[model samples]
Target: MQRYFVPKEQFDESGVRITGEDARHIRRVMRMNVADTIICANNKGDAFLCKIKAFEDQSVIAGIESVLTSESELPVRITIAQGIPKGDKFDTIVQKGTECGAAAFIPFHSERTVSVWQKEKSEKKRLRLQRIAKEASEQTHRLLIPEVEPLMTLDQLLIFSERFTCKAVAYEETAKAGVQSGLPSLLRNMKAGNSLIMVIGPEGGLSPNEAERLKQSGFLLCGLGPRILRTETAALYLLSCASYHFELLQREVDR
Candidate 1:
């Protein structure tokens, strides 16, 4: 069934009320009508199998058939702290990262970051990314949409990361130095439900001084592998490894 994310307030004992573009998409694009079933998620980690009940004044009301209980999220909450890359690269990151089970994203201004955000346009750009994350979450059947947090400076990012259970920075220099144990070692210590923040630098990567500051702030410095990756690719790669360790390997361990 097609999935739509509705605000928690839109849900009630009877049904979910969906409005705006989603209502139009249901009535026009999907050609859905009363009695047709679809999946509705209340971004608070609850989902329902709903049957279309009524369409009124630009809204589609779907009666809840049953609650959905399957899980699609990663075992650990992973937040991608990306140094704001140039162009539309961040869009690709949010979309693919949501599919890969990232829980949230934080775009940061690093010493090597090239793109500068216009003060007036920053909110607009963030809203756009938020929309992309929502659509991607629904498409992937994610229990909740990954949040696209406000853009922050490197200092602000490090401070914000203080609350996470684990923190790491992906430094290409470490890869070049042939240090491969950091990430795996970190994952070995990770437990289910812990939150992790993985920082990936922009185009030129984090400056040596910036990497040092991160390490001083308790962020582990890790390498993706021997080959260096573009700023955008590093987050996806980290998420892939996390899924492999927490989801794939955990199943084998369980068996």
Candidate 2:
């Protein structure tokens, strides 16, 4: 079934009211007609099995047939704190990261990050990333739209890591085998509701002193694998590993 996400305000007491780009997509792109059954989700993870009642220029009204709680969210909430990379790689990061089920993203300024976000550029990039996140969320049928938070410094990221139940910083300087290291075990052992945070640095990677500070702040220094991965690649890789371990592995075990 085709799925669409609408804002919470679009849902009235009776059903959902689709307008703007969403209305255009349903009417013209999807070519949806009256009495057609489709899935309509509010931003908060409430999905309704809806049948179109009316289609018009300004709005498309649909009656709620049934509402189901969304099961698309991951068991472990994973947040990626990535050091802002140069060029348009951040777009790739936000899109793929959303698909991999990231809860939130933090683009931080690290020592070696080639791209600098001054006042105006920072807001522009933040807005651009946020729009990418929204599109990616709709494409993936995600219930909650992951946020592309404002840029932070390395120190800020370290401080923020304290909020997570499990926190790890990806550092190439850490003297350990990437996948074979304790990282896998640590991730696997996390309780179902635990929130995980993974930190990925820029092109040159996190500085030694920065890594040490993160470690001192209680973040495990883990390696991705023997071969080094790019900044954008690392964020997706970590989230994928986490989803496989926590969500897919448990589902397989239960069956």
Candidate 3:
């Protein structure tokens, strides 16, 4: 069944009303008619199996059939703080990162960052990324859409790291030095429901001064592996590892 995320106000005791782009998607794109079943999720991450009740005034009213209970999120909340890269790489990062269970994304400007987000274009770019995250979340059956934050400075990102239970920076120098246990050790100590922030630099990578600042701020400088990864690959790699450790591994242990 197709899934649509509706605002909390649109949902009543019995059903949900999807409007605007989603209604158009259901009416014109999906061609859903009355009685067609679809999944509707509210802002609070509650999902319901709903049957289309009516189409009225550019809206699709769906009656709740049943509540859905399934775990589609990772045990740990992982936020990706990436230095702005060139071109559409950030879009791909958000799309794939959502599928891999990233809780949020923070795009920041580091010393080596080449792509700058001017004030005029920030909102437009953020909106595009938000759309990508929503589509990816629905496709992946995620209960909540990953948040895409406005671009921040390196100092702001460091300050934001204080809110996370654990923090790490993907440093190529660490990989070159064959330091591989930092990430695994961090993961082992992390408990369920903890929040993590993983930082990745842009194409030119982080400057030495920035790395030192992050380390001073209590961000672990970890290696993804012995190989160096691109800015886009680093975030996905961390998310995949997190999912395997927190989701797939835990499932096997439970079984």
Candidate 4:
């Protein structure tokens, strides 16, 4: 079933009222009609099996059939603090990161970050990334949409790291030094429901001074294996490993 993330106000005793772009997508793009079933998730992260009850003025009124029990989210809440990469790489990161179960994304500017976010176009860029995260969430059947936060500076990123239970930085130098134990050790120490913030630098990667500052701010400098990954690949790699450790591997252990 097609899924749409509807705002809380859209739901009532009768059904859900989906309007704007989503309604257009359903009406024109998907060519859905009355009696068609779709999955609707509310602001509270609850998904319901809804049946289309009516369509009027580019709006879709879907009646709530039953609440869906979705367990697709990862046990751990992982946030990717990615240094703004060039071109459309951030878009790909947000989309794939959402599928890999990232809770949120924070794009920051590091010393080595080449892509500049002009003040004039920052909001527009952020909104585009947010849309990507939302669509990817729905497609992957995620209960809650992953957020794409506004771009921040290194100092701001440090403050943001305070909110996470664990913090780590993907450092190429660490990988070069054959330091492979940091990431696994951090994961082993973390439990379910823990929030983690993984930082990855942009194209040229973080400078030594920037890495030192992050380490001083309590971010672990870890390696994603011995190979050096691109700015976009590093974040995805961390998220994939987190899902395997906290969801797939844990389930096997429980069994």
Query: Per-residue lDDT tens digits of candidate 1, residues 101-219?
Result: 99999988888888988778888999999999999999999998999999898889978999999999999998878877488888889999899999999999999999999999999
Residue-level lDDT of model 2, residues 1-255, one tens digit each, is 777788898898789888888788889889889999888888787888999999866789999998777667888888889888999999999999999999999999998988888977898989999889888887888888888889998777877778899888888765334345457887877887789888888999988888888889898888886767888898887888887887787789988
Q: What is the lDDT of residue 225 in candidate 4?
A: 81
Whole-structure CA lDDT of model 2: 0.85
Q: Which digits, one per residue and each the tens of the lDDT, describe model 3 over residues 152-233?
A: 9988887888999999888999887877747778888898889999889999998999999999999888899778888899
Native-vs-model 1 lDDT?
A: 0.91
Candidate 2 regions with alpha-carbon error over 4 angstroms: 175-179
Candidate 1: 10-residue stretch with minimal lDDT:
175-184
Best by lDDT: 1
TM values, all candidates: 0.97, 0.91, 0.97, 0.96
- Candidate 3 weakest ten by summed lDDT: 176-185
Q: What is the C-alpha lDDT profile of model 4 across 101-209, one tens digit per residue?
A: 9999998988877789998898899999999999999999999998888889999889878989998888999888887747778988998889999888999999999
| Better candidate number, 2 or 4, judged by lDDT | 4
Tally clashes: model 1.
Answer: 0
Q: Please list the residue runs of candidate 1 whose C-alpha ends up more than 4 Å from where it truly belongs after superposition.
A: none
Give, for candidate 2, the lowest lDDT window spanning 10 residues.
Answer: 173-182
RMSD of every prediction: 1.0, 2.1, 1.0, 1.2
The C-alpha stretches of model 3 lying farther than 4 A from their native spots are none
